[model samples]
Target chain A: MKKIVVSLLLSLSLLGLGNAWAVDSLNISLAPEQANPPSPQMGDWLKFHSVIENSGSQAAHGVVAWISLVQVDPGHEQPVDLEDWSAHKAVTQAILQPGQQVKVEWPMRLIQAGAYRVVISAVDRETGHVMTSPFVDFQVRRKPVVDSGRILPVALGVPMLVLGMMAWRRYRRRTGV
Target chain B: MNPITLIARKEAGELLMSGRGLAWLLALSVIMSVLSLLLVSNTELSLLDNAQVVYMVMGTVTALGALLAVVLGSDAVAGERERGSLMPLLLAPVTPSQIVFGKMGGQVAGWVVMYLLSLPYVWAVGSSGQNLTQAVAYLALFGTPVVLGFGFLGIALSARLRSVRSALLTSLITLMLLASPLLLGPSLRQSAIGKLFDAVNPFSAAVNSFDSVVIDSQPLAMQINRLAISLVWLVLTAVFAIRSVRKMEI
Candidate 1:
């Protein structure tokens, strides 16, 4: 009985030490609201919801979370201007507790259609440490080319005729023909 | 026909047959064809692409129209004086105002040719596209006055100068000076002088108006300040041109 009790006490103390030694860290995840409309089109307003989790034992204060649209270029990624992209409601969570999470939303308008990556970054004010989430691949497609198929020829032809007549009149006058 | 219309028709015929007219037409055609092909060949379409193309077309057309005005009106009186034809023209039944109006009309005809040349390209990019009609309408509305204003200024400078070469040079220089406000950097553009220049300059006003209407998708009513400024400039320039014509010798 004594041996069994000592064994149990040792295991419990070790578990407590392990729990006490746990480090503080922040985690973030971003997700789009709907499965449908998976890809955003130009001029479409998209909502990105991000969950910021404090995976550590302590509370995090002045935790700022921001979402950014980035274009992956050769050898580097360029940040798209939020102003030009029509981003709105970029949110921040002031306080997050241990094992607690807060949700933030970024409502952005897809102004220019192209391939991009959505990135969410959280900065802990106390530690001045910044944590970034994995890139969310995205593509914006252009609206289909407007078929003005029949109108194209007429549009071109009428102008050509007008220009030709003007030129011909000038030619006749110049040559006195 | 009105005296202005008759004189305008005669002058337009002369311009169309001239070497410069053919050159401008050829250049303009090539530009429009290339731009249209590029715009249509693209598989994906967006409002920005259409707006950008429209903006490019507007800028190119306006600059070219201004060039035509300078080329055609710069010699309205000075070149005639140099060639000893001013006396006969001034002695004709048309008054000085009529002559000015006639020459202005001829420049306007050139502008019409440019506008027509750009229509197909504009249509290809803008038809059925958002803000296309507004872009085209703004181009026409503000574009007409811009061309007319530049033509009047060119004719005024030509009337004031004695030599064709001198008049042409002076008019071109003045155009460059007017466009300087647009070339300034962002920091400088916000300065007092920059603000003053942009407020009074017709070209800048028109370009800003285009931005507001097309890119911002603002209605025409929102562009009253810019439109008003351009109109004021147009009137001032026209008045200056008329006064110069009246005071012109020979």
Candidate 2:
């Protein structure tokens, strides 16, 4: 009985260590591309590069990586949906070999003015383990790209001009002007 | 002037200079103006991506253009017949094909005016975004075929049907059926049947092309398949319209 109990405890400890090893095998680092503007304005395009390295002896299978944005403003903080910013949000790697490193490039447009932190998160489907990169902070300054005042004149004027012309043509035909 | 040109000019003048045509154009401009103002001035909508704004404007313009085409095309033969004016046109020195082409020219004129009117709105919403030129170009490229195809479909129905009301109703219903796929969510659209319908739907092709070019920043080479679908619609409808007019009595 004593020997069996010791064997059971030893097996449990090995299984826990294996699970921890799988969880720590993948490491991710994310950063803005050097070509990106240091101070981005609203409507500016930005690119980010993330590198995922597998350091363990076992390979990572069915790994998926995606970007997440969090607005860290003082008064309002919330996670942002990337639906408008990017069409291809998540990328998958079928199999990542041991000691292999893969790079992902994400191109996004800054739509609103705010302080944001972006992070790359990855999950290994085989191991059910997740890893996240350190957040990269960025600021998008307010730049009014659209001028409604300019649009108002054309939007309102064109129709009015057409109506005036129609009325004038009718009046001329009636009076032979 | 050639018979076709003369007939085209007459049809265009009747549609553009008439009170009904003026009313349709006016309504189109007002709707566009209100939509543009809201998109630019609203706090939430203003924050949307510029390419998204452009895509929305392009879609709206195309829909409105198609609506105008259907209205005018439905009235092409049936309205004239109802007013006892089609007999004189039929007796003129023009073939059935020529009449169909001339009426199509009128629809083209209406589309041109609508496209021109939409330019300011497109520019206002999408000037700051990427693919501005591509958006404008694709709108013209894809919108022309889709709008013209709807016009041809309307003309075909009008030639075959006895009354303008029935033709217009049927055309409107067909338009709604074709446009229904657009309202489906992405998940639903990815289903097997949905994907199959989208593959053949010209409306989907145009809107999807706009999304790809404006929002996804895809190149023009990628739009060949979708453009082909739209072109196929145009060809099929044009042939149907010509045949229907040729077989019509009185």
Cα RMSD (Å) per model? 6.7, 3.7
Q: For model 2, how does the per-residue alpha-carbon lDDT over B122-177 read when each residue is reduced to its tens digit? A: 88777765678998899999999999999999999999996899999999999988
In candidate 2, position A2 carries an lDDT of 92
- Clash counts for all predictions: 0, 0
lDDT of 2 by residue, A80-161 (tens): 9887777668888999999899989989888789999999999887666578999999999887667666778878887897
What would the per-residue lDDT of candidate 1 be over residues A76-167, giving only the tens digit for each residue? Answer: 56878776565453557678888898877777767666788888887766664567777777777666535558346744665475578668
Worst 10 residues of 2 chain A by lDDT: A142-151
Model 2 regions lying over 4 Å from their true place: A1-28, A49-66, A83-106, A121-131, B46-49, B182-192
Model 1, span B139-229: residue lDDT tens: 8888877777887887888899877788788878877776564455446778788888787888877877776677667788888888887
Q: What DockQ does model 2 achieve?
A: 0.40
TM-score of chain B of 2: 0.95
C-alpha lDDT of residue A131 in model 2: 86
Q: Rate the local accuracy (lDDT) of all candidates.
A: 0.73, 0.86
Task: List residue ranges in candidate 1 displaced over 4 A.
Answer: A1-39, A47-65, A71-79, A87-107, A111-138, A142-163, A170-177, B16-23, B31-50, B83-85, B125-130, B180-199, B216-222
